[model samples]
Target: MPKLSNDKNSVCSLAQKQCCIRSLNSIRCDSGVTSAKAGRSCEGDDGNSCMDDSYQVCCSCCALGLWMRRQGQGCDADLHLGPSCGHVFLTCCEEVEARSQLPLRGQENLKPTVLPRRGNGLCSQRCSTAGGRVLCSCFPGFFLMKDGHTCEGEAQYYVDECAMRKDRCGKDFLCENTPGSFKCIPKQKCLSGFTQDAHGNCVDINECSSLAQPCSSSFACVNTVGSFNCQQKVLVCNRGYHTSPDGASCADVDECQMGSHACGVGQICHNLPGSYRCDCQTGYQFDALRKVCTDVNECWSYPGRLCAQTCENTVGSYLCTCTAGFILASDQKNCEDINECDQKPCSQECVNMHGSYQCYCRQGYYLHEDGLTCEDIDECSQSIGKLCAFQCVNVVGSYLCACPPHGYVMSANGHTCTDVDECKVGSHNCSSEKTCFNLQGGFRCLSFDCPHNYKKVSSTYCERINCAPNSFDCQNSPLRITYYTLSFQSNILTPAQIFRMGPSPVYAGDHVIISITSGNEENYFSTRKLNSFTGAVYIQRKVREPKDFLIEVEMKLLRRGTVTSFLARLYVFFTPSSI
Candidate 1:
């Protein structure tokens, strides 16, 4: 077999005839003719019938190899000098026959040849055939790269479709981006009780107006963010009714327990079901105008008819009192008289007065100094001769008769006394010539006559005779006669006369001087010359001692050639004063 040319550019630079044949054997053009000349003839020469000329045949196959290269096909032939011209033509003709089986117009270069796929790690899908070569592409949701051979997954983010293509979606719709592409959906699909805002988001629903109201008649509907709720209303109670603790239910109100009643002081309030009443207590009566209880005075109702003597009225009661000499009985309404002499308060006799008593003594006795005791009266000493005859003796409440010492007896009158004549009764002891005399207390009998210097005045009675002249010491004698002796108590209020002494016969030329000679001297007793013949003694001061005072007052008289003197004694008994 002959070898064909392997130089592609040189082979394709030939005429268009027989372009489909490439593989062919080689031949010698008349033993020395060159291969270039043979190639030239095959390019333009048309061969006629020949007696199996190898050079002409070989040149026809060479022209076929160049035509195949010009049609952009590969040639697998070796171009070298050989004696295989018929076998090369047969091989070229077989390839031409295989390509001719396709459609004749657009299928001129088309073939059903198998394409070898490329090994691309970045390809995300299977390989496909295009124009007799393998192409790498992506699966669904992916895209091809710029080199047109590798594939990648689609992008997850959205892109502005309007910015890219202004009319991407129509006016009634909005463009919504998907993972790899975009679509157009309706602008709004809002739910019930909800509305879309300007920015295309669903907000809350106002059930108070737009939808049906869900609250009751006594309740109110409130709207919230995307929801609504119902609230119950506050209920009001009527008069005498109050709301319960839960502020929903109504209950009856008790005015008495709540201290809302109009009861006054001292009035009791009684509670009823829905009202209250007032009542008064005992000893009190209700007053309509004052709405209170008033006290009733029972004492002033019946007056004095309730008591016997005197009636006094008090609050709800009365009192009684009796008159003089009477007392109130235990019944508190009656009076009883009292007996004043009931206890016998007198010693002898008791006489009842109206409200007192009087006491008296018996006939033989008299009321004592205390008036409650009786004592005897000494009648004999009270009246001397009227109570007795000769001598009176006092007895209890009476007098008795008594006799004298010389033998007297009582007369018929119990208080008289009489003397008996001794000679007539023969009770005397006189002789025949001797005379006996009877006296009240005694009787005497004479025996001798009196002397010459004394004369007998009566039997058994004699007195002293006058003194003789010059027979007495008249001037010098210390014994002077006391004419009158006087005794008096020392009770002189002022300078008063206690005693007086004077000469017996006052003469015209007589003069007397008097002086207190004894006693406590002039401290108690004093004297004064009253005239020329008399002298007077007096108390000088108040006597303070309970003793006897013997005051001697001396008087000296100057007479006609004779001086006579006398002394006066004053017995002043200084007894205690009564006051």
Candidate 2:
């Protein structure tokens, strides 16, 4: 036998020669070591186990031959035994010594190895004891030991057999793992609208024909790959209809605003759901079943009410016409009154009303009966004494102011009478011998004092009243008489006779009386006294016939009962005019 040393200088050939001498089954481990069989003591050495020259250590007697063969030297190859023969082995001595120092099973130490290895092949986890026997075991993911000492890997780790060798299965099959071998199953997958059968083949599913399909009765289902479609049915609408918002129903179309109505001009279109109507506008009406608009006789509709003057009917409308003096107004329906007075038609004042005008006058004027003309009012005749202070003279529309007979002027307010001073305006008819005196409405005259015997006879002069009866100027010269001969043709157209008789220097007390005598009996001849002291003769006649006449005139003077007589002769002749 050879002994193994821990020296680094040992020769390798020395272990090969000595390791062949011992039998592999003869080695055993002692009790009291963790890798040894419990209750077994070694027969070779105390605490000593087998260690060959190849550095193979054996803590059990059964693995000595198998452990030596694995070193690949010239060792025993005929000792054929299974790992189940219960043995444990190690290659290094240091690992065996370290595991032997652990406390034995059921010892009171806290870090004790409670169950030791059964036959020296160390288990991956622990060993348990039961019924006075020891069995080796691994963790939960591993298996029980076959060698009564050690455990191998788990069996759930499936091997990839196809990856290693592709011919493990046929082309139409899939490879799956079993405990120690693999199986070939056929490959298949169903399409979208199909399902798988028990025979491992894809089959078509009729979604449209099946009762359990997702499509409703109102819809149609379409089949696709692995799916189906639920489509709503289309609804057909009438001529003037369109689809509803839901896209499944129909609704009517309005044609009024859409310009589909057949209404003509002057007509209005009214729309219904499926039809339209034509109607006439205001101020117009449809004729006897006519389609277009026609004129409406408003004048005839309401008799005598359309206009104040004339009402005329036109095409589709009516007109209101006024007479000559009036005009139309703004509102076409109602006839408004025109203001004819806007042009100042009246002479004085104008008033306007419906379709007419009126003329009025001021205070002193009146409206004529013609209703348009104005005339002046005769205020003088109407208001007699009230018009002026004294008298009223009528003018066209007014009255004139007059004063009394004196030299008077009218006042500014023509109704008041006023007085004027004749003395100041030189209007008095007074002589040189008299003095004028102013009085109300007139003037007065006063003569100067005459001589003692002459009494004032007039305002201008005075004559002497004392005279001698027969003196040269006494008795007014006895009423001196004068004679003259006169001739007149029958054609003389004069109606007066001319003769003069007077005595100069006559006294005022003398009296003369003249008369016609003898040839004056026809009364065509006559005489007149020229003054109180003188006499004159005059004759006048219309000599219608051719005749000759002799006339006599007498003059007499009477003073103090003495009479003086005087005679004068007058002759007349007629000459006939040839017819």
Candidate 3:
């Protein structure tokens, strides 16, 4: 066994070599003391020969004690591991001390032999030795690296203390992170219309109460959300004037345009800048006390000088009127005599006088009891001798002689009657197919005709002669042809019945068809059956001018299974409307 010396330098020199030996052997010592025998005591400055197992164990314990002391841990009292240590411990101890004092190096270079039981390891920040392994962690603003032995700065692996609920900021403060640390700042900043209180809260600023004379003398200041408003004051103006929009001035009001003036009838109102004037109309006088316009009576004021005749006074004017037989002249102030004859007041004649008129009658008339009317003399009854050779008639202001109603007319002497030649004068209503013969008081229309294969049987009827059994021409021809004449004025209405053809004595189940066979080229006539036995023809179109139509109406009668046709020669005449 080797003996250890009592000299501090020699002992420390021996402890360094032994510590290295223990480290190489992977041994651990908790109290900086190894579990080995005490080494042999080595004297003097030469302790190199003290290599005993006990001395080596004791020296290793001494070296560890010195290192622990440099790390701010007290060394074992028995080791004397202060500045008095020898060169053996000084070299290794100095090296260990140098490494421990250096700033936090990388994880690979940081190695500590003995660490504290709880939070002590080769870590940049917090450390733990749990389950025989060194684990590292960081503070609120720092983060642990992958090595589990080092902590990264806040800039590299940033940790949001606010988001992670690890900040120490108050409720009114905002937490902001920095390198390896955290900061607290006020949460809100005061803005316009708001002020910050002692507790850092924003409160509304009452500008209306805070400012001096914010509004003018005529306005009232009112505070609003984030602003202020000034409202105008109410004002009253004098009569004939009104307040302006801003309540700062006054403006004039027009009484005439607004119809507010107290001007009476017959007065005109005129407007001034701020007042009105009332004036009287023509022929009216204004009464100042009554404030009204009164009519001027010219008749009483100027009498004869104003009008030539009568004078009258009216509201706002005067009038000049004439007498009963005179009129007002164009000058409106004089009168003139009216020509009464221009009005034709008399039945026969009229004559004008200075201011009146006269009425008279002609030779065949006499003035009535009324001076304006003239009545006939009735010469037909009042005459003393025969005045006419025919009947006498009286008319207005004259007398005349009239002939009989037919076949007679008055001669040129206007008193003798003469026969009228109806045929020569063409006055009879006879068609072209008939002859008109004059008689004593009337005229006669005669028509005589016989168609081919027919012979006259009577004055108006024609009979067919003998024919062969198979002669269709003689058989089909009318067995009897009758003549008819119709007369109408041109003013007759359309659709007039002109002729009716049917059997004289009819039996049952008798039907006839009537049609205008000729002289209806203009389609003016049509036929219709009134009953089974009677058929009639009508003038369907109006004849506006005097005309004649000779239509042959044929009626085919079917009676008792026998068919026989008859012909009627109708002569239609339209005379003048006056006849």
Candidate 4:
């Protein structure tokens, strides 16, 4: 490559100008340059000098820098200078007036002169001119080399406009880098049911309104997110034939199969073409108004023909029942008597009757309050009179009359009691000195003796002996003493006169005072004066049990001014009331 001086005057000199013209025929220009006047000298006082207005001067390679200086610009080394003066010039100058007006051709034969830089020619990737200077650039992924003309780097080595803050996207836009370039994308992206507007906003899309006839004529269309749906239409049909689900046609409905008929529990349902019928079961009747089955009461319908004794109604049947004491016969309608005696309901004896039984007791037994068991009859407690003269002993079924162990005997009647003569029968235990006396139910021995001043007058009486004139004992002693015995039952009434005492011969002027002196400690016996001479001894209190008493009765007689006393020894006995 030929070199040019930095001095513009030397680059535009005549010698350098001639030398550029010789080289111009073989050089090529990549860009166009302006023409100048013909026959003009290449020399000028100012540094901005050029050749004449001709094609030779415009196509010359040396006059490239002169034209630039004349155009008030500077030369860059990276620019290409062709051989003809019509190409971009950098160093020499020349002129050809008419040739400058014609279009230049034959650039393949023209030789190109590039400044000393890295690259095959002006640039490896891109080349341009700006501000009167040649610029070399690379694609987005590459960078300019140190030579200022070549591009270096691979596809992976790129400039991130986003990270480097070199993108022209606004706040609403996102910067996306590509292999050799970058793009501005909207940040707000539209979803399935929406679309993006000019302002980059997401707006809803009315698919229902926008789409043409999306649903069939029988269905209504409904819109959804990113989709649509079809719904069935409503329609009415005639009776028994209902409309289909799609509302396109009508079909028959089976009332019996669908359980929609008005048949009762015991009725059966049958389906027809468009209607239904209900039938009653056996022994039942159908009611037209209620459409239900009713049962037939056979007992009420047949009355006496159903049963002999009684009739009862049952569901779909009848029943026959007998009275309390009767049972139904094998014929199921007639009644038969029940034999109550077979059950042995009575403890003693049971007699069967037509419909019941009677209870009877044995000879000595009677019926108890319960009417079933027999109990012993207490004759001893029930008899109003004395059934036995002595003690009546009650046995299981009868009573027995008992006599005293020694002094009484049971009579031949077996219920009467008799007194035994112990003296004559030799059953008494009396000594030789005592006399045996018999009573109703017992016996007692009696003996009387005189005192020293008295003499016995009889077996029961004693008298005092005569006294001398000075005998005081004889004067005061009893003139007579008598012994007596009495017997009675313990049921004897009180205040009974049991004994009486008086002088054997009645005297006109005799007054006696009588008293019981001993053996009356329980106050059971008392003495009373009657007519001043006769006095009686009476039993005052009744004895409820058998007892014996020996009482002494004393009497003082005041007659003719001489006092005389008498004594009576009385024996009283109380026998048992029943014996």
Score residue 4 of candidate 4 by CA lDDT. Answer: 21
RMSD of each candidate?
Answer: 54.5, 46.6, 34.1, 44.2
State each model's CA lDDT, in order: 0.50, 0.49, 0.60, 0.62
For candidate 2, list the clashing residue pairs, or say none.
Answer: 88-120, 88-121, 192-225, 192-226, 193-226
Better of 1 and 2 by lDDT: 1
Stretches of model 4 off by over 4 angstroms after superposition: 1-386, 394-398
Prediction 2 global C-alpha lDDT: 0.49
TM-score of predicted model 3?
0.27
- Local lDDT at 357 for model 1: 44
- Local distance difference test, candidate 4: 0.62
Whose TM-score is higher: candidate 3's or candidate 4's? 4
Tens-digit lDDT track of model 2 for 1-579? 111111121111132223312323333222222233222222223122222211122222223322343344323221211121122222221133333443464132212122222345433233334454544444222345567654433312333456557336877788875433457877666666777687877888777776575776556788766677889878888877877777656777777788887888888888766677888888888775756688688878974566655678877667877554456656644445466777887887664532455565533455677766778656558753446555667899987867766545567866654445576678888887656644334455543455443444443234455566555554443233332334433444344434544322243477877777688667765676667865655546667765666665666766658676554444455533211
Query: Which of candidates 2 and 3 is the stronger one according to TM-score?
Result: 3
Please report the TM-score between candidate 4 and the true structure.
0.33
Q: How close is candidate 2 to the true structure, as a TM-score?
A: 0.26
Give the poorly placed runs of model 3, Cα more than 4 Å off.
1-434, 437-447
